[model samples]
Each structure stands twice: as structure tokens, then as C-alpha cells.
Target: MSVLRMQGIEKQFSGVPALKSVSFEVKAGEVHALLGANGAGKSTLMKILTGAYQADGGTISIDGRQVSIQSPQDAKALGIQCVYQEVDTALIPYLSVAENILLDRLVQSKGAGLIRWQQLYAESEELLRGFGFSIPVRMTVEECSLSEKQLILIARATVQKAKFVIFDEPTAPLSTKECERLFQIIDQLKKAGVGIIYISHRLPEIFEICDRITIMRDGQHVITTETARTNMDEVIGHMLGKSFAEEFPKAHVPIGETLLEVTGAKGGKVRHADLSVREGEIVGVVGLVGAGKTELARLLFGADEAEAGEIRLKGAQLRICSPKDAVDAGIVLVPEERRKEGIFVEESVKNNLSVATIAKWSPLGFIRSGLEAGQAKELVQRLGVKTADISQLVGFLSGGNQQKVAIGKWLDTDASVFMFDEPTKGVDIGAKSDIYRLIGKLVEQRKGVLYFSCEFQEVIGIADRILVMFEGQIVKELDREQATQELIMYYASGGE
Candidate 1:
């Protein structure tokens, strides 16, 4: 029997339909996959199922009985739990891992009495150990990395004895080894007869683990089929509504003289790193999590102070002590964590776009609103940022649009060297293409670019050269023609 079912589910936001007449089901012990592009309504449907958003029209059934769920508590009461894509918002930063994991159970067990800290710690430790997680129970959630937080959420769901669990892009932040561990946990959950709804853009993972697949496009369901019956090509065509010619649209640009060079740079996790980027070139940096890719970017961008290094731009040495110093030296970084580090969430799109160049629009300590608005409007059109108005809060935009704003903020400056850390991490395929084209444009303008990502395919597709880092060092450097997935992976995994 099917453990969960939804019929004619519909949802809308600000008069725009997010999900239309969507029907879905999951049987006991089944790993069901949900596939879609950004803005394809997959998240909206799951939000409704979790009671985070009420559907405009729909009927939900659990165990063949109709039910009404109006809030997250109601959904939990019916044995439904969700691990959303944005992990930071899902967890409380100030609380310890154990407290966050057993919060619900602790309240229930208390029954108006004092709490039992000893039992809670013991239970939380045992639960984590069972899942192969070694995180300390008393460690604050704020101190944990993104992957650790993801595992914590999964452990919490498992402990809740959820009959139905929804995992939304759970592997986006995980390394290969970490992903293998997650798959193992999922295997255990499946053996326990939990109906799972898995959502992801990574096609290979769906084939490897999912039993069935459901494709959605433009707020509508397109197809639902057994995984063994359909191939990647068929699935991609269904999700996109057409055949995709190439996964990566690489552009050719002539390489020029060196624009930026680093020698013996050491900061944070990065140790004795050396690299160079020439004008009209895109140099890709590929590494696993904790391999020091982000640390190198931060050192170059002056987000972290370098203890020992020589940084040169066009044969001129630079002393960059902070982000302001880096910007003044004609360098900028588009950070990986867009929501937390890159954007002013509560501000307007225009304000965000003009943030880096606000001083340029101010004359004699007076702000020139007209000039700022004009620049923001031009960037919005050039970057194809879809928004109702420039005054709209940036927090309300979709992931793709938000990323565009993050990159656009840097365009208003005169910086000639650009560094992007996981620029397309959570974006969809179409948006990723857009970002690639933008990078190509930067190269065509004779700007030097450093692109860092964990995905080898992205490094191979967009870069003129690829540098593999392992254990905080550049272990191998390969030209565009010589780099491949296997070769990059070998060096990225510390191969000699």
C-alpha cells in the first residue's frame, strides 16, 4: 500500500503559480526521486507537504485516509519530516547539537517537569554513533561546517521515527566520501520501510539510489516512471522539455599576459600555494571539501590575512590586509555562501547592486541616487536578473536571481581580477549556463578570472586551465586540453 499520496496539489505566490495540479505518491520502502530545474515548483510542492506552505487546492492522504495539515507541527504529528536545501535556516546556531537533535522529544518527555540533561546527552551520542557520525554532542551548531549540519538534520529525522522523509538537495554541500556515508544511512532507512522523497539535480545519484523518478517542469508534473526503465537522456529531456545539446557551454578566448600571481601564500587551511591567472583566461581550481580551495580564495581576496606570501598584479606587488585593500588593489571575490556572506538579504536589489560602488555614486559626501539607480538598472538588464522591480527585497528572489545580484555587485567596480568560489553551487542548469556566459564575457573583456568548484565537470568545461589542490597545496596543474575527470580526481584526492 502507498504510505503517502497527494492529488491535484496547487500553490501560488504573489499571483504566480508555483505548483499546478501536481499529483505525487510514495510507497512503503521506496526511494522516490523528484527532479526539476530551478523555479520548476519542486520546492513549492515539498513545502506544502511539510506544512510550511498551504496549498491553494489539493487533497493529501496518509495510509489511504485523507488528512488536513496546517502547520509543521501537524505534519510531524502525521509522521512527515523534511530536510530543506538551506541548512543554516533549518537549525538554530546558538543551541548545541544534542539540544537541537532531541528538542522535540525532550519537551514531550519533560511533561512540565525539569529536564534530564544526562539522559539527553547519552541518547544523542548513541544516535549519532549509530549513524557513523562522530560530532560532539555539546558542540554548538554554529561551529559545525555545512556538511556536519546536514548530517545532524538527517540524524534528527531518523530519531523522530518518521514514516515519510523528504531530502531536498542533501548532497549539494557534501564531498564524495561524505555522500557515500549519506547513501549508507539512506539504505538503513529504506530497510526500515520508510518512504523517502529525494530531490536533486545530480542525475547519476538518482540512478544509483532511487527506485522511481518524477519529473516536474513549469509548475506541473511531466512524468513519473521507474528508474530502471528511463535513461539520463530521457530524464533530462523530460525535466527540461527539450533535448539539451551540451551540459557545459564553453567559450574560447585568447589568453593574454599574467594579471595576478601568488607565490608561497599561506593562510587558514591554505599552505604554500602558488598560482597565476592571465588576462582573458579562466583558471579553474578543483578540490574536495577542506582541501583549501576556499582558503586560497579568501587569502587572495584578503578575507583572511596571509602570514607569508608575495602577491603581484601586472608586475606590481600588493599589500592586501583586508577585503577593502583587495578591492582597492583591483581584485574582488564572489563568495560561495551567497545568502550569508555575499548579499544584503533585507535590502532592495538596487541597493545590493550598488553596495560595492556606493562611494563612486557619492560626490562631496552627498549620495547621487540617480546614478546608482541607472547603474543598477543597467546591470539588471545585462545580467538578465528577473525581478518585479529594482526596489524588491533581495531575500525574496529565487536562488538563481540572488546569485546574479551577488555577481552583479562586483561588476560596478573597476576590479580587473575576479574570483568566484562555487558560483553555481545551488543554481539550476539554465542559470549555470547563464553564469558561464557571464564568465566568458569577463574573459573577453581582458579580465583575469579564477573559478573554484568541487564539481570536476564544471572545472573541465569552463576553465582554460585546471589546478588541483590537496591538503592545502596545489598538487597538479593541467591545461584545458589535458584535464579530465579521472586525472583531476586523482590529484584532488592527494595522489602523487
Candidate 2:
């Protein structure tokens, strides 16, 4: 039986249709996946259902009863809770774990008409223990790791007793081991008659967790089918309106002379590193949380200081004390957090695109808005960045589209050596394949690129060679042809 049904939902933003006649139904205890590229109307549809946006046309029926959800509280009262892609920010940082969990329903004392902190703490600890999670109950939100924070978020939601839970990109910040734990928790929830709406760009995860899958493209519902009835290729086929074979292209371009060489460099979580990457080749850096992969990029780009070491580029010793020095030398680092580090939020897509190479385009000692606008517009179309206007504020864009803006910044600058740290993180599956092709394009231009990813599968797909980092050191390096998940896991977990 259908527990929730949404029919002919229609929404528009500034006279532009965001969702057109979209419809779907979720059965009790089913994990229904909502799929789409960035700006593909998935967010809009959810906003309508959760009362963030009032639909212009459509009917939402819960258990065959017509209802009007005018606010988030209405949705919650109807047993609806949303866990968006950026769920971390939804938490209160100053609150303790127990306080955050039982926020409003803290057990109260009767006689004194006062709040009961002790009762809240004891009940919260028991609630967490029900799930076998042993996290510190008194710890503040700021003290928890990303994985801990995610688990706590889920726990808090499940405790709400919501019959329908919407999880958006819950695995983005979790480790593989932690992800396994979450799947286990979801299984328990399913047994308890809870329905889940899992939204993620990870195709494999949809297969692993979802009972039914719904594909959306360009703000329209493509199709909804059973997990066993469709293959990955067919799903990708529907997403792009055609086939995208070889999603991860292995560049066979000849490896040029060594373009980057580092010896004994130590910064952040990185220590005593000696490594080199050749021009026109892709080297992947793989590691778990706090493994120093990102810190290595920071040191190389001069965002973080080196405790001791020398870096030589093209056989010439270079002193890169800051990001400007590195960029002037034709090296670029695309940081992991696109929303925070990649671009300015309030700026136009055009301005953000030109930020890296603004000095070159402004060599006449004045800004060239015309040249900047043209270049930004061209790059957006070339990179398939979906935006109605190139002059739109980047903060209004989706996660995947925003990432393309970050990549466009470097492409505009024509950076030769690119460091891509989680370039495809938080992006939909469709955009990931596109970014992979862009990486191939960079290598075709003889640009040396170093890629870092938590997903070992992605490393195998793109890297010519894989360097595994653990505890601030490169413990293992394997040519792509020789690497395997078992091997990568062995190195990552200190098995080898």
C-alpha cells in the first residue's frame, strides 16, 4: 500500500518551470531513491512536499487523505523529516550530544515546574545505546568527527518516530566502515516500518540501499523502477538521454618530464613527503579521514607552511610561500570544499570564473568586464554548467553546478598543474562523469594533475598511479594497473 503519494506536482521560480507534472509514491518500509543532476528539480520537489515552497499546481495525499502542508512543522507533524546534503550545518554546535538529541522534549520535573537536565541526559544516553552507538553523550557538537555527527543526526531523526525519513547525501562525509554501520541502522529502521527517501549522486549506493529508484532529468520525472529491473548503464542512459560509456577514461597520453618534485616537506597532517608527478599524467592520492591527503594539497599550494623541505618544479628549485607564488608558477589547487574555498558566494558566476586569472585579463591596469563576461559565459556552456544567467549569484546554484564554476575558474586561468581534491564530492552521478571527462581534457592538454578521493573505486577509474597515505605518510604507491580495493584497504588500514 502507498503510504505517501504526490501527484502532478508543478512549481516555478521567476516564471521558469522547475517541476512539471512530477509524480511518485512511496510504500511503507521502502527506500525510494530520488535521482537527478544539480538543478534537475529534485530539491524543488522536496521543498514543495516539505512546505519550503508552495506548489503552484498538484495534490499531495498522505494515506489517501488530501492535506495542505504550509510549513516545515506541518511536515514534521505528519511524520516527515529532511536530511539535506549539508546536514552538518543543521546541528547546533554549542549543544551537547544529549541536549541536541532530545532538544524540545527534554524530560521536565513536575513539582518545581522546571526543566530536567538529568532526565534528558539519561534518556538520551539510553536512546543512543539502543543503536549500539558508544559516542560520548556529553560531548559538544563541535567535538564530534564528521562521521559521528552524521550518525547522531540520523539517530535524532529516527528518534522523532517519523514514518517517512528523507536522507540527502548522508554518506558524503562517512567512511566506508561508517557507511556499513549506517546501512545496518537503515535495515533496522525498515524492520520498524519506516520509509526512507535516499537522495545521493552515488549510483552504487542506490543499488545497495534502495528498493525502488526514480530518475529525474531537466526537472521532469524520467521513470521509477525496481532496483533489480534496471542496470547502471540503463540508469545512466535515461539520465543523459543517451549512453555515456567509459565514464572514467584512462588517459593514454605520454607522460612528460617530471613537473613536480617534493622532498622532505612537512605541513598540516603531511610529514616528510618525497614524491614527484610527471606532466601529462594523472596521479591519485588515496587516504581515509585525517590521512593528510588534503593537507598535502595545501602544502603544495602554499596555503599551509612546510616545516622543512624543498620543492623543485621542472628541475628548478621554487619557493612557493603562498598561493599567488604557486599560481604565478602555473600550479593550481582546487580545494576540497567548493562552497567554502572554491568561489565567492555573492559574486556573479562570471566574476568567480575570472578570479584566478583576473590580473592577466586586467593587464592594462584596469578591469575588463566585457572580456571577463565573454570568457565566463563560454566556459559555463563548454563545461555544461546549468545556469539561466552567467551573471547569477553562485550561491543560488546547486552543489554539482557550483563545482563546475570552481573548475571553470582554473580552466579560465589555463593552469598547467592541477590539484583536484575531491573534485566530484557532493555532486550528482551525472555531473561526476562530466567532471571525469574534463579531467581527461586537462590531461590531453599535457597538464599534470593530482587527484585525491575517499572513494577508492574512483581512484582506480581515473588514476594512472595511486599513492596511499596513512598517518601523515605515503605508505604505499601502486601503478593503476596493479591496484585493487583489497590492496588499497590493506594500505589504508595498516594491513600491509
Candidate 3:
């Protein structure tokens, strides 16, 4: 029987249609995978159903009763719970794990005279144990890793005994082991008759757990089909709105002399490292979270200094004591957490775009407003960033649009060797293709880009040389032709 169904769902923002006549159904004891590129309107539709956003048109039915949901409480009361894309969507960082888990519904005395901490902690522990989670219930929320927080969120919805659960890219930041644990938990939930709306970019998890799959494009439903009948390429084609043809366009560019080389580096959490990124070559670094990938990038970028090592740019050994030193040496890193470290949310897009190249644009602390605005506008148009005005607050833009601004910031800097960490994270499919095209353009300019992502397909599809890292070590190296998803995952999981 269908636990929940959405028919003719329609929504828009500022006259821009987000979802147009989308329909889907989730059945009890079944995992329904929602597939779409970033900004494809999957999250928007779910937000409407959860009362976070109001639908301009549609009918949502729960077990045959048509209902109107106007807020999260309404959705929760109707037995619909959502674990959003950002795992800590509603979590308080400073609060204890138990407190966060039972935030508003804390067990209290005298109808809210005071929260019963002991009972809450004990119940939280019981809930975690019920879901086979091993973490201490009394620990602070900030103490848990990204995956642990996700597991806790899943546990929260499952413990609520909700009729349907919607998970949005819950495994994007999880380690391989943590992902396996989450899959097991999902299986347990399914056995208990809880319908799952599993949303993820990772295809393997879709194949592993989903009973049926629904593909969405441009906020409209394309098709919903049986998991057993559909192939991966067909699903991908539907998500991208095109068939997969030469996913990675790796051209045989004439690689020049080594541009930057890191020799025997030891600093921060990263150990001895020997790597080189050359002109006109995309060298990809692949590793599980906390396998020293980010740390290595930090050391290379001089965001953190190496305790013992040497960095060479153009055959000259240089000491990178700060980010400016690295930038002066023609090295730049487009960070993984673009929101935290990248664009200024409060500033205008044009200001954020020109901040990186203020010296080059002015040279003497003088304002060249016209030059900056023109450059920002040009970059925005080229990257296909969706925005009404350049002066609009970046905080208000979609994740993918914000990412374009972040990348555009660096493009204005004119750095040759670029290190991008999860360059496509949270970017929509249309924007992702734009980024793919942008990366291709970078290669054509004979510039080097070091791309790192947990997504195997991205690395396999982009890099000229792929280096697989495991436990803070490079385990395997494959050329573009030799690299495949299975081979990369094998090396990533320490397999054959």
C-alpha cells in the first residue's frame, strides 16, 4: 500500500519555477530512490511536502487522506519526517547528543517546569541502542563526526515511529565504514515497514537498497520504474537529461614541465608526501574522509606549513609560510567546504568575486569598482550562475550558485595550479555540467587542476591522472583510460 503520494506538485520562487507538475509515491516497507542533479527540484518538492515550503499547486495524500501541511510540526504530526541534505539540518552544535536527539520533545517534569535530563539521556541511549548505534548518548553534538551525526538523525526519525522517512544525500560526507553501517540501519528500518525516500548522488547505494526508483529532471517527473528493470546508464541519462556519451573528455594535451612538486612533506595530520602537479595535467587525489587529503592540500597551499619538507614551483624550492606565499608562487586551492572558507555570505557577489584579485585590480589599495563589476559579471555569465542581480546577497543563492561564485573568485585570481576539493559538492546537474565544461576550459588553457572528491565517477570522468589514496597513502595510479568506477572503488576500499 502507498504510505505517501504527491500528485501535481508545483512550486516557484520569485517567478522562477522550481518544480513543475511533479508526482511520486512511496510505499510502505520499500525504499524509493529520488534521482536528480543538484537544483533539479528534488529537494524543493520534498520541502513542500514537509511544510518547509508551500506548493503553489498539488495534492499530497498520506494513506488515502488528502491533507494540507503548512509547517514542519504538521508534517511531523502526519508521520512524515525529513533528514535534509545538510545532515545537521536542525542540530545544535553545542547541545549534548541526547538533547539534540530529543530537542523539543524532551521528557519534562510538571509539563515543562524543567527538562528531565536523566530520563532524556537514558531514553536517547536506548534509542541509539535500538538502532544498533554505539555512540555515547551523553556526548556533545560537536564531538561526533559528520557520519555519526547523520546516523543520529536517522535514528531520530526511526525512533519517532514515523510512517515515512525522507533522506536527502545522507551519505555524501560519510566514510566507507560509516556508509555500510547506515545501509544496514536502512535495511532494518525497511523490515519494520517504514517507507524510505532515499535521495543521494551515489548510484551504488541506490542499486543496493532502493526497491523502486523515480527520476526527476527540471523539477518535473520523467519516470518511475522498477529497480530490477533499469540500468545505471539509463538512470544517469535521466538525471542528467541526456545519455552518457564520453563522460570524461580527456584530451591529450601536451603536458609541460613540472609546475609544482611536494617532496617528503610532514605537517599537520598529513605524513610524508611526494606529489607533483604539472602544467596542462589534471592530477586527481582520491581518499576517504580524514585520509589526509585536505590536510595535504592545506600543507601545499601554505594554509598550514609542513614540519619537514620542500615545495618546488618551476624548479625553485620555495618556503610557503602563508596562503599569500602560495598564491604568489602561482598556487591556489579551491576548498572543499566552500561555504565555510569560501565566499563571504554577507557580501555582494561582485565584491566576493573581486576580493581575491584586489591587488591585481588596484595594485595600490585603490578601488577600481567598474573593472571589478565588469569582471564579476563576465565570470558569472560564463559560469551560468543563476542570480537576479550581482549585488544580491550570496547567502540567499542556491548552493550550486554559491559554488559558482566561489570558483569564480579564484578564476579572477589567475592562479595556474588549482587544487579543488569536492568542486561539485551541492551543485545541481545543470550547474555541474557547467562546472565540467569550466574544468575542461581550464585544461585547454594549459592550467593544472588537482581535483579531489569522494564521488568516484567525477574523478574518473575528469582527471588526466588518478591517484587513489588509502589511510593517508597513495595506493594506485591510473590513467584516464585505465580508470573505472569499480577499479577506483577497489583501491579506495583497499581491495584488489
Candidate 4:
């Protein structure tokens, strides 16, 4: 059987150590989970393996023979592939699905002859069909949904016939059905002797699909064990370097009069939906992908204009035409696509934390840098945002830290209703704890929070109440004590 192994892997970024003497190996036809919290060197190790970054020191081997992988081409030639979570950045939006799937083939065969478009589309269609998916090969990637984009990446990897494939948070954007499809593809790959390296923050998925698991912590290998030998609590403890008890950190904050109320709100994919968030309450909106949860948040936050609805804040009617109007009306949303829409990644953490409320620090139409810095420092500490200082670019931080900055930016605003759509989508367990605690603190301050997410378990843990959306409408509401995963799925699937 083929084997891929890396021993004594070491890497540093700007003189800061990222990976320290890490070792990992995977055998052909086995699903091996490479797991760690964000910034825990798992990504660093994978980058070195995929040739995105070279290790400062390490030895890599395949089937007991040392191999050199200095670039992505070298890795690809050696039958290695990676399916990253950031699908849009990796895909060509204007290209047809077939072209994107066969991109490497086109690049390799450049100037060979006239491209046979029909044959290419036919091959792509067959490939997708082989995987039991029905994505239109002729459709432009831009027209495909987020989940479809993820599948395209997976398909591209399979077409490459990779010996070792790494799936990084593959289910982050996928629906239940799409996730099952992905699992089938993984199963097929395994049966064909492909080594699968799966990485995700969801413990349930890991326990379900992976055969063996490797845990990393603080740039070092913690343990490698058979999946059947460890439990979720044990795995989480190893990942966090300590025993973790409060996974959700939900606290009791007395619910008060309604702080924000929406009636018949309609926008993009959102139909006439009604909801309310009381002071010191967290009301969760849960749904599968394309179920209009995000659309509802967008309309409430004025990211999209409402065609018809009444949004009242503290019993005062507000006309919100745009995001600015929503912010001015004391409503703010931390969007689902945090990198693209929630925060400016190119800017520093301090700047990101202050941008939304810069006007408050700038009485003379010029921002007081000192005051802004001070405020940022406080928020960073409050939000537990890990950075080399507030001036570090937010793009350099881990997913969880970046998310903290995204939510922190709006803390200074006069927004009473804070809307977070999938705030913990890619965040890890430790960071998720911090975020949940932050939400608790927000509610303690009597700030009504609208937590929109597909992670029903998380919502059930942290939210006092839950609203399930189906298609473009809210179909059911359940208190935390009564909500269950099965019930949420039933409502999300349009049950009466």
C-alpha cells in the first residue's frame, strides 16, 4: 500500500515558529483526520505538504522513499491535491463548470490544437454523473451556488486522480444532502485506494467518517490514534491542551421587552417573515443552505432593502434603505461571508475594529489615531483577538481571530440589535468558546442579538429561543428547552 509521511516538519513565518517538529503520515485507502484548533500548526503542516509553503526543516517521504515537493506542480505531479474551503478564490467565476474542472488539463495542453468544447463538456458531465451529482457542465461557475462550487473543487481533485487528497472544512458551506454526497465521494475515493486527509472543527463528522485521527496543539503533534479509541471529549481536551467543560458558555440574561421587531419583512430570497428579539435575548435563526436565513438577516440589517416590512427598534419605526441606514438606526449585521463582506481584510485589526464607528472618534472629521488605538486595544483584549498588536493585518490572523475582529468592529456602534449570520462557520472549538462567551457578555449588556446559523446544535446551546426557516420563510419557533436537531431539520425541510 502507498504511504505519505512527513517527519520533523518545521516552519516559521517572519521569524515566528508555526510548526515545530511535527510528524504525520497517512496510508492509502484510509481516511485520516488532521485536526487542531485554528492556528494550531495543522494548516502549516498541510501547506508544507501541498507545497504552498516550504518547511524550514523537514523530511517528506512516500512509500518509505524521501521526496521533494517545492511547489504546487511538484505536489500535483506526485499525486497530491488539496480542496480548500475558500472556493470562490480558487475557481474561475466566468468559466464554465467543465472548464474549471479540467483547468489543469487545459493549461498542460496549451497550444496543442483547437479545443474540442463538446468533448470537454461531455467528459465533465460524465465525471459529475459518476459522482451522483447533477451540476450542469455548461453552467458558468458564477451561476452555481456555494455548495456547488465546493463540489466542483472536489471533482477537480478527483479528475486529477490524486493519490492523497486533503479536504479542508469541506462541509462548511454544504447542506445536509450535499454533505452526504461528499461523503459518498470520499467513500468512493477510499475504495479506489486514495488517502484522504480530512480537517474540520465538527467532531461528529470526524467520528463518523474518519478511520484514524491525528491531533495537533501549539505547533506540536499531540497524539495520533484510531478513531474508535477516543471520544469527542478526549479529542477536544487534546486539541485544547486542557480539559474543556463549558463548550457553549450560555449564560442567563433576563429577557426584557422587545428591542427589535420585524413584521412581514421581504427581500431577495426572503419572503414575508416576522421575528422579534427582546433585550438581553439571543434569538437564533437556523436553516439549511439556501433556506433564506441569511436573506432574512440581510433584510433586517439593510444589507438588502426590504420590499415590504415594518422594522421597529424599541417601539420606534425606522426606515432603513441601506446598511448605513440600518447602522444609523441601531441595527448591525456581521454577515455570513465575513472575509468578503464583514471586515476589510487588507486593513489592520485596529482599523477593522474602529471603521464602523470611526465617526465617533473623529469629532473634527479626522480620526484621532491615539483614541482609535486605545479603543482598539480595549476591544481586542475584550474580544480575545490574538494579534501581534492592533496594527497587524486582519488577513494574517486565523479564521477565529478574523471573525472576532469582524464582530468587534461593530461593538462601538450604537447598534442595539447585533445580527451575526453564521458567525462560527469556520471557527474552531476554543475560538467558538470565546465567541459564545462574547455573545453572553453582549446579552448581559442588554444588547439583543440575532444569531443566524445552520449549526443548530450551537444555536440550541447558546440561544434562548430558535426560529427555523424553510425556503424563504420562517416556519417554526421553539424555545431552547424544546428545540432538537431532528425538530430543526423537520422545520427546515418545510414540515407543517
Candidate-wise lDDT, in order: 0.90, 0.85, 0.81, 0.91
* Model 1 C-alpha lDDT per residue in residues 397-489, reported as the tens digit of each score: 767788999999998689999999999987867678789988888998999999989999988988999999999999999998999999998
RMSD of each: 1.9, 2.9, 3.1, 1.5
What C-alpha lDDT does candidate 3 achieve relative to the native structure?
A: 0.81
Model 2 poorest 10 in a row by lDDT? 103-112
Quote each prediction's TM-score. Answer: 0.95, 0.91, 0.88, 0.97
Worst 10 residues of 1 by lDDT: 425-434
Where does candidate 2 stray beyond 4 Å? Answer: 103-115, 319-322, 360-366
Sequence-dependent TM-score of model 4: 0.97
Residues 11-52, candidate 4: write the lDDT tens digits.
977677888999999999999999988679887798899998
Highest-scoring model, TM-score? 4
The residue-by-residue lDDT of candidate 2 on 205-265, one tens digit each, is: 8999899999888889999999999989888888778787777767678988898888888
The C-alpha local distance difference test score for the whole of candidate 4 amounts to: 0.91
In model 1, where do residues sit more than 4 Å from their true spots? Answer: 109-111, 360-374
- Clash count for each candidate, listed in order shown: 0, 0, 2, 0
Model 3, clash count? Answer: 2
Rank by lDDT, descending? 4, 1, 2, 3
Off by over 4 Å in 3: 107-119, 130-132, 345-351, 358-370, 388-399, 426-432, 475-496
